[model samples]
Target: MSGNDILVTDGLSKRFGDFSAVSDVSLRIQRGTIHALIGPNGAGKTTCFNMLTKFIAPSSGRITFNDRDITAMRPADVARLGLVRSFQISAVFPHLTALENVRIALQRKRGDSFDFWRSKSALEPLNLRALELLDSVGLTSFAYSKAGEISYGRKRALEFATTLAVEPEMMLLDEPMAGMGHEDIDRIAELIRHVSANRTILMVEHNLQVVANLSHRITVLTRGRVLAEGDYRTVSENDEVREAYMGAGHA
Candidate 1:
């Protein structure tokens, strides 16, 4: 792999008995870039994502992160290695205040188990950093609000905050724009851009507009295989990509 690549997959594949969900999908996600994996429904985007994050084991192939072979690593172990998945594996506690939720994630990063029995003062030291994280995601004003009570957009932002607490080298976002309105989509898109300044992000998103606006590169999948990959313009102009999306009724 090139030095610029933070994550690489070689011939990644997954199968369910006689069915192949993903086949020979190879990717090279460069450091500090926002890369999107997009395809029509049932295109194996989710299966590929699950394997990358170690949510499910890949039936074959190898995954490398920062030069380490992580194909067989467990999810938590992968996360601890600074490759974390957000959204689909959200760590936010809905009933907890946004501040508390981020604080818990911070505690986890520090290798400290949740100390619910401890007094509030014991955890107060994490408050400053937690509040900073909330501010980063534009949730400082809602820091005291219960996570479940916040607007859906803000909830996703809070998820970003919690994920940030891990100080991940890479983040795999599963449909960050899913279920979001225009305003929320814009907010999260900008937030994703801001957060990508120093870390690598690989996202699977259905919003083509978001993919075009935010991604530095895109991989198009169809029928469990890569149809094309390049910058938005290049991939968008590919004849095969156009036919694939149109045939799948995505456009």
Candidate 2:
């Protein structure tokens, strides 16, 4: 860990039987910036993400977040330290309204018991914060709607709101624009930019245009190893990157 990096990985590796999913991957994510990890399909992008979120343990390496070694930390422990991963659509409770969902996240952040259901006054204090979170993600219109009833884009915005409820110092977003239309993508991009003003964000996204536009720094991965790391123009113009993308049929 250095003065510049909020997150650092040293010689991270993951293996499954004869297959090596990630090999000697190291990354430095600067404080209060949007950093993106991108690669063609089968480039071990997802595996690397899993490791960082502590969803899967790395076979060998160290992961330091905010100057603490989290290589052996559990996912819940990692989250408690203010490093949180955005949940998938399925992770949200279908029966709960968007406000209720964000309220639940706020409750968890306060380390309160799930017994908020018992006392109306107990959760009243969280309502204001939850509404603020919903507004931040542009989901204020859907605040009272069921999370499952919203459009795909709206559901994602609600999820971002719920993630924000946790007040993470750094957030890990997985493909925030994966299934959005152009308008939805644009909206979500702006939401991300707004929230990132005070915190660091690292995301794994396939949307090259989104990454190019939003990321302050980018790390390109190929064959389970880092192929390049720099600004979009520098990485995009690299001959090796062009060849790799072309070979992968993604150019």
Candidate 3:
């Protein structure tokens, strides 16, 4: 792995019985860059992402992060090393207010369990940082609202705030634009761009326009293998990519 690369995968493959989901894939994600994994439906994008995050074990391969082999690490162990998947820590409490939810996450990061029996005053120290996180994601105005009462877009913003509380060095976002209207998509996209200013981001998204606009590098997968890897313009112009998307009845 290059000095600039924060994450690397070698000969990564996954199989279910006789079917291969991801095959001999390798990747080098550079530090502080937005790298996207995109492909048509059933192209193993989710399976590959699951393996990278350690949500599911790979059939065969090696994964290294920050120069340490983490292929066998548990999801929480990998997350503790500063590589976190968004929804992994975004178990937002519906009954809690926005501020409370983020504060709980901050407590978790500090190796403190949320003390439900303790007085609210005890959590005051974490409030400032939690509020800052909420503000960063444009959720400060809703800080006192119950998380379940917020709009879907704002709920997603809440998720971002909670994720930020963990202080992940690299964030893996899966289908961040899924099930969103145009305005929500734009909001989340800007939030992503803002937060990525200081950390590396890897995302799997089907929205080609969002991928083109946000990704510094794009990896295209087709039928369990890498078809291309490059910037938006280069990958967009590749004949194989064109065939994989256009010829296979994908847009």
Candidate 4:
């Protein structure tokens, strides 16, 4: 990988039986930028995310993160390198308070055996940082609220707090604005912007408006291939991208 890029993929491809879900794709994500991958439904965005996160193996490809090859690394191993993802798949404990949920995630990062409710100094120290993370995501007021009792938007923010606890150098956000009302969307957008100042972000989002607002660069996928890549203004003006969205009834 070039020093300019924190992540690079060459000819990434994935297959399910004989069906090709993603075909020969390449990407270079620069360090300290918000890069977005977008497409109409069935455009292989999820496949690429899975492959990059080490959730699934690509049929043929090479992925390098910060000058290290990661195509063969396991998911946990990749996460240890500071390439972490946060989304619904990252379970938030329902009964745990917002602060406690974040504390658990922090503890997991420490690899300490969970001695639940045990009066140990090891677990107590995490609370301070956990509360700080909650504040970072604008959830300080809900610190004592049960995770399940919090609003959906706040829960998502809590998820982000936990993800941040891991101190990721690169974060893959899964549709951060999905199902959010305008207020939540705006809040999360600002949160994303704030957190992205010193880290790299690669996200797969369907909300074009949010994508336009946050993305430093955008890649458009169609039928499992990259059809266009550039800034939002550039990709939005591309005839092929418009046509692809129109044909998929997304335009």
Task: Please tell me which predicted candidate would have the highest lDDT against the true structure.
Answer: 1
Worst 10 residues of 4 by lDDT: 242-251
How well does each candidate superpose onto the true structure, as a TM-score? 0.94, 0.94, 0.93, 0.93
Better lDDT candidate (1, 2): 1
Model 4: runs farther than 4 Å from truth? 88-90, 108-111, 114-121, 246-251
Q: What lDDT does the true structure give each of the candidates? A: 0.89, 0.87, 0.88, 0.88
2 or 3: which has the higher lDDT? 3
Which stretches of model 2 miss by more than 4 angstroms?
88-90, 112-117, 246-251
lDDT of 2 by residue, 1-251 (tens): 47889999999999998899999999999999999998888888889998999999999999999899999999999999999987533357779999999998898855758574586677888989999998888788888899989888878878888888888999998888887788988988988898897999999876567888899898888889999999999988887887885455545
Q: lDDT tens digits, residues 128-233, model 3?
A: 9999999999888999999989888888889988888888999999888888899988898899998897899999876667788889999998888999999999
Order candidates by TM-score, high to low.
Answer: 1, 2, 3, 4
Taking all chains together, the TM-score of candidate 2 against the true structure is 0.94
- For model 3, the stretches where C-alpha displacement exceeds 4 angstroms are 88-91, 114-120, 246-251
lDDT for 54 in candidate 1 is: 95
Residue-level lDDT of model 4, residues 168-251, one tens digit each, is 999998778888899988888888998897999999987567889899999998889999999998988888988876455545
TM for candidate 3 is 0.93
- The lDDT ranking, best first, is 1, 3, 4, 2
